[model samples]
Target chain A: MPNQDEIFTWVHTAVEAGANVAFALSGLLAGIRKQLDVVGICVVMGLAAFGGGTLRDVLLDRRPFFWVDHPGWLWVLIGTAVAAIYLLRTTHYEFTERAIQWPDALGLGLFTASGTQLALAAGTPALPAVLMGVISATFGGILRDVVCNEIPTALRDRRPYAVCAFVGGWVYVFAVRFEVPPATGFLLAAGSATGLRAAAL
Target chain B: MPNQDEIFTWVHTAVEAGANVAFALSGLLAGIRKQLDVVGICVVMGLAAFGGGTLRDVLLDRRPFFWVDHPGWLWVLIGTAVAAIYLLRTTHYEFTERAIQWPDALGLGLFTASGTQLALAAGTPALPAVLMGVISATFGGILRDVVCNEIPTALRDRRPYAVCAFVGGWVYVFAVRFEVPPATGFLLAAGSATGLRAAAL
Candidate 1:
């Protein structure tokens, strides 16, 4: 079996890449809805993609932030943002308010699982680990809404956003405790979160 | 002379205590103006008091956030917030829009100098350290404004808010480089930033 360090590296890289794309799309749609300028769009996109993980790293005392270490991910985020803007501008497919929920839910589920696992790896207890998952999943949207000058939908909307993440994170922790394969545990967590969020919609 | 660790501890504790009180006051006044509920008031006060420092620690990979290490500061922040709310409600002293500027500027100046110094201690180069200072000083207010669903005053107010903090940080850095006492350097930096912001107002 690979060492703990290898496992951490694998988990961090995979989740970060997936969540970055998902959150970037959400941010791009939100920015377009707000009619922000190009620079503003990029700023919001970057924040949405990176803000949650950045907060997690900070709280965990992890250094040399993920984006800073892999500058290529930033390029990927920018490329996705630019392409999204082009598609929206050229096509008749308008980004309806409801369309953002899909990407947001995807990013939320992915980040929730990843953050919970990371906290567990860092030796945090179970409950705080779950809380970490919620923060990682929800904070990016909160920041995005705040930047857009709106009350964070997470706080204002009575929906089950953070609740889905919290339940999914607990599922992962229990699965891991029961000797579930690490990859399978991740899938279970993400799938549960995404399924619940989609159902809520 | 004290060792580097000793110096860091002294600076971190002193600046943290002072900035906490100042920013807590600013946040309390802001919450009262906005008419947030008690829980909302506490959250804003905590964020204003700790947001910038938390950001800096995350960037620098510092562990066990200052407030986490010394929970006493949380009490201080809470006490200040509660008192401010009580005073605003009981006294005829209306919290005019202008009252916020004083505590905000004071917190900005103190946090700017302390953040710059901490970054230097973390071995960050001069320019990035200056930027960190500006971030530490201004981000709390930005977060507060954003949470309140207003455009950040630092971004909106054509006034030289961040600029003042930047200049003050540089002054502190240069003073330390020229063999000034650490305390004196801090004073110089805080005074310069507060004076500049007050003058701009």
Candidate 2:
């Protein structure tokens, strides 16, 4: 197994890069579906990309927040929102509810893994660490839905959204305890969550 | 004037005790109006009481969150929710939307002053400190409204909700700068916000 520090750094960077884009796309789609203005779309997209991490950081007492330090993520969110808007305007493909699920699931898995890892690194207990992971995965979508004046899907959807993240968080925690390689464990955990969400849809 | 240290301590305690009760009552009324289940009422009340402070503490990287230290707040929230429910059942008084505005405004002002003070104590710059004050005042209501599946009144209400908090926050900040007595400053700031909101209503 690689050094834990290295694993932590890698997981953080990977989640930041991959999950931001996935969640941003998900938010953009939701915004478009809600028929929000461009500014509203950007706001929702930013919330989806950064909301969970911001919540996690606040709970864990991490300073400056993830997006505050990484202004690049904001740029990425804005760019994606703009591109999505342009594509919808110019293209024949209709952005459907199903399209949102794919990116949302992917982002959920990635964020759950990363949040769990960070909490554990900060010496949080196993249960709260797992809860943090779930929060990181689901809170963004909750904020987006709330801002759009809809009941958050995480709270009301019959489909297993938060449940998928919770289970996947436990999977990642167990993988680390068993000394599975970091990259491999990340994939297993994230894949489990993404696959479950996709199947549910 | 009392020492700034004493003033800070007094403001923190005052806001904690008063705002928790006020906001909890507001949440209970909203929950009752929405016809939420008991658990939903508790959850909404807890969010209204702790949401803004949690946001503030998280942003400031304050550890062992306020409620974590004062579990008493949870009991107070539960007690208030239960009492409010009992009162509604036993009394002829109907819970009206207007009934909520009074407590909400009081909590808003107190929270704004305390939040700004804490941020400044932590050495944050002026504008961000003021912004933190506004956040501490308004975010709880935003969370409450969102959970109830309504657009946050702070965001959409034509009446001066957040604006009152913003103005009153600056009032508290300048009061301190001008060496006003702590108790007087507190009352002035809180009253300004509450009065403005009441007038708007």
Candidate 3:
């Protein structure tokens, strides 16, 4: 159970790793659905990967957003999407599904925690922070669905996706307020989110 | 030149009509691309139509956003997209393009004016208001581009799109500051935008 600074650093590292994996898998899914080309794959992956954080920063009026600060962030998605698309062409759907779930779950958890933290830092109240957390966790997928011309899976389906984010976010908030060690709280929230999602599946 | 109130009325009318057309077009494009079912078409259309305004409101932190206040706005896009998609398979692209461009131009002009006006209302400085106007005019297309996995057309090729918006926005700002009638300023701004886009093409 590390303190706040260490927990924040850990969260950042996890999110970056998770984002790359999510970007790759999302591209593979888009290609499998035949709604994307090589260029489209990379584009969707990048957009889906970065859209949430960009929205968070814009709303907070934080200049030089994550993708802007780290130019490599954008390219990571580009490279991952390209590679994923190529590999997906010959891979089995079952294997792809099996491989993608964990990273996606990681991204969902890390984003939920980080988004809540951002909102709190920006002086948003608890309810709004929770909403922002869910938005940060799920907005990328919604954007992807809209662009792909599908009903957003989050809105249409009764999945545990956003619900897990909401619960995890509240857990993080309560833990922080109680002065619990941040790392322990973050891990607990993420672990619970992953468990819920896996159970839902 | 029309009075301020009259100009505002016209601009509002144009937005209403253009919103319908934009929504319709999103469905038509999605259908042509064969990426969606009818429900998906409706979702895409609604998002395309309201997406810009929603983004603007979120960035501006204006509570009870336009769409939230008027749920009818959502229905309007839904109906329009449905009708357009149903009629689209039998239509010719060239003819459709010609008819749609007029409303789109009107929408662009009005959106630019409204965006500038809103920014000014929010007490943003003149230059920022002008920039906001341009963003309002072009953001829908950017949203469309992102969803379709293309570089934002505005940022891609130099098309005089944002330039037209900036000039028109300044026209509105100057008129308002000179105590010219609001409607007169609006028409001048909208007309300037419409003509510039036409001429550019």
Candidate 4:
């Protein structure tokens, strides 16, 4: 079995990557529903994929945005969006709309955990760190919705969306405050947040 | 008479303060229309007042957000919101709706010039600086509308809004390129942008 440090690194990388994909997928579906052209579609997809993380990085004063550091994700997102457009052409609107919730929930969980973790690592105090997580988990979808000319469903829906992220952030914070292993905290936080959002959906 | 440098400083301060007040008032009006409570009113107002500038600062990795440095603005904003609530309660919706445009336009002009100038000072390339100006001038209202569960008037209105900012940003860039006085650049850029938006209204 791998050491705790390797496990923590692996979990960290996975959560970030998973959140990026989930957010991008959600954004792409939203853009498609809006009947945006390819360029517009790509822009929204990229925003959903990178917006929250970039905001987190900006607030934390981290340099070289993840997308900048890894241009490969852009190509992959575009390719996926194009392929999905054709694949989902016959897919029902109701189906696509329903499909969005899954990725959105997953992204919320993953981003909340990762954003909070990163802030804690940067020495931010607990409450502000939790807020950073909520912002990271929620703002991308908000930006996408705003650009698409809709009230962000995150705010509009009666569902507990940002609340889940907030609670999940505190979960991670407390886990760290105690002596829980970092990887375990991440798993528990992400799981609970995603589960809460999924239940709301 | 004050020298050119003194005039530049005065103009800079005036434009930034003007933009902040305009944005804040616009947000306050929006919140009142939405019938949000006072706390909601204040949150939305602050977002419109500071969202764009905060976004610019984050993107540029600037430390000490404008609000953090000037807590006095918070008190002023809250006090103004309270005053406006009572003062404008008897005002007609049509009149208030029309009123929002003026301050919003003024904010657009001032923020566009200031954002672009700050980016230029930070050594961002001309095109990126212009883009930054647009973001700074526009995102605050977008944020306000998003929270208010309405389509952002910036995107919905048929008037060429963001385009005006773009053109004005270029005007500033060109003025600087030609070595016009900095104050003159600000005045010309702000005037043209505000004029263009006012014409649109």
Candidate 5:
């Protein structure tokens, strides 16, 4: 198990990787849909990265949030967007189709688990915790879709994306209540969510 | 001069126009910046149209904001966006530049007034009222800029847009306190905000 600093670093890396993948996928969708230019692609990608977290922070009345304080997220997003365009030019749709599902699931899992943990730490009740889990996991995609002028995949007649988040949140809650180590509980919850999402996809 | 219903009709017309113009401009900007696609443009426009009110409603804890209830605004934004593409294509940069200042000021005025009124009606303090006024007038544009990967124009070292909103809100409060007719007072406040913004521009 990692120390606190190591854990934070790992989480940040995972989140950044997740964000980059999601943004790249969103940009792909935007490009295919003819809803964006290169700049628009980057914009959509950035929204896919930060939109959920921003909304969650604003709603929870949290100050500064991660993006506001650590402005490096902006550069990360910009770099990822540029990389995505270059990668997309050479890569085929089949490549993305095969490549995206795992990381997307991982993103869903990690974001949901973190969201649930944050809400519980902030003293929100269980229901709100689960809701935040889903929100944190899915809202960036939702915002991306909305900006792309498409229905949110979570809100549409899609597979069980939010359900995975909801279930994972409950798992974390139970794990904490049973006095499991925080790291173990978070990892278990995130793993469960990712597994569920991957299976659905 | 008009009855309440008539006033609402005018208000509705102006709101529809303002909302469309705001979205259309944002879309155009996104296109020029080469940052968005068709869906991306539409999203930018829709968010630009509805984001301000949604933010205000969410902050004030008002449920089922007007956009969520009235889907007509969505259609309005769509129409405006489509119309704007061609209109913008034909229009010269200088003409577009000249056209934007007044509408922006008008939107600021109307949105600030409505936001202030809603906050007061919701029983928030006076300070929050002014904040909401600025939020309602400018946050949509801010969100648009942020998503488009640009610094929010409102936060830039430019004209005192939010300043007009803050001062205009106070002007509204004084007018109401002085028992001025609501319509007259509203017009006066909105007019003052517009004038201030125009002068600053």
Candidate 6:
């Protein structure tokens, strides 16, 4: 049987990967709406997928960026973007846009939890670490929309997007502070954020 | 008498300080245009002034941050913002906006050159180093506008802003490659970018 640490690592990686895919899908949809070329779409996808994590790493002074550490994820992103472009061509924009919300909420939870955990591990103070989680969970979409010349939905949308991340980050921090079991604490944090976002939607 | 390296450090610090003020001033103008409150104005000012260098430092894994290293500069920024707010309230909007161009252009040059030089110092490759210069020169203003919900002037302006930075970065790179004296090379790069941007304006 795998150790708790091993299981946490696997689950963490998978969740982040799924979250990345959700963000990349949103980028693809944005690119398609903007009528961007293939290169533009890829660029947007990369920014949308990695911007938050990159910002978090920078804030924490971490090395080997998330995308750099997982080079295969780049290929995965490209494949997802290409496949998505084809699949969504016939889909209604309204439905496609709404469909992205589910995974985006998942992304909100997992990214917030992971980003907070990373910050705590790095020995950052609580409030700033929680801010890091929010930044990690939201900055990618902000970058995408800003690049596309639209107001960032994270900032402008009425729904409680960043609030979910904020709550999730605090949950993780409190869990760690209280010595909750690591994996369970992580899951609880993520679940709260995802559930909150889903409820808001 | 100070050594050559000592002179370089002094000159670099002064130029960067001046550039930071210029960016903060632009941020003030932006905040006033958007009618932000006092705290909002200060937040925008900080983001506009430090966003680029912070981004570059993060990319290069360099620390302590420029503002952090010079804690006095934070006071300077607040003072400048407050004083400018009082001074500009009586001035014509058109005049204040145009007056900002001179310093903004100067910032573009110095920031581009310094960012590239820093990248080179970090052992980054040539092309990537030049790109870093462009990012350093441009990204702050981009963040400022994005936060303000306006399209980034860096992206939309027909003027030759980033192009000047690109050229300036190459000038610095080539100067270093060919064994030019450091101070002269730095000035040459800055002058080229400033002149180019001024001409475009």
Q: Write the per-residue lDDT of candidate 1 for residues A89-175, one digit (tens) a residue.
A: 798877665765676777778888988998889877676676678778877777887888776666546568887898899988998
- Each model's C-alpha lDDT? 0.79, 0.79, 0.69, 0.81, 0.73, 0.84
What DockQ do you compute for every candidate structure?
0.16, 0.18, 0.07, 0.16, 0.04, 0.12
Q: Which stretches of candidate 5 lie over 4 Å from their true place?
A: A1-12, A86-95, B1-201
lDDT of 6 by residue, B55-99 (tens): 898888887667655657767876777776677777654547687
Q: Pairs clashing in candidate 1?
A: none
Clashes of 2: 0
What residue runs in model 4 are displaced by over 4 Å at the alpha carbon?
A90-94, A178-180, B1-46, B59-61, B66-201
Output the better candidate (3/6) by DockQ.
6
Residues B69-173, model 2: lDDT tens digits? 566666677677778778878998876666666666778878877788788889988778888989888888788887989778789878788888888878888
Q: Per-prediction TM-score, please?
A: 0.59, 0.59, 0.55, 0.61, 0.54, 0.61
Report the lDDT tens digits of candidate 3 across residue range B126-157: 99888888777777667655555556667977
lDDT of 3 at A42: 70
Tens digit of lDDT per residue, candidate 6, span A18-62?
889899888988988899987889989988989999988878888
Error in Å for residue A56 of model 6: 2.5
Query: For candidate 6, what is the DockQ-based docking class?
Result: incorrect
Reference-based lDDT, residue A135, model 5: 90
List the per-model TM-score of the A chain.
0.84, 0.84, 0.85, 0.88, 0.85, 0.92
| CA RMSD of each candidate after superposition | 7.2, 7.0, 8.9, 7.0, 11.9, 6.8
How much is the lDDT of residue A73 in candidate 2? 74
The model with the greater TM-score, 3 or 5, is 3
DockQ of 5: 0.04
Clash pairs detected, candidate 3: B2-B184, B3-B183, B4-B182, B4-B183
Candidate 3 docking quality: incorrect, acceptable, medium or high: incorrect
Poorest lDDT segment (10 consecutive residues) of candidate 1 chain A: A150-159
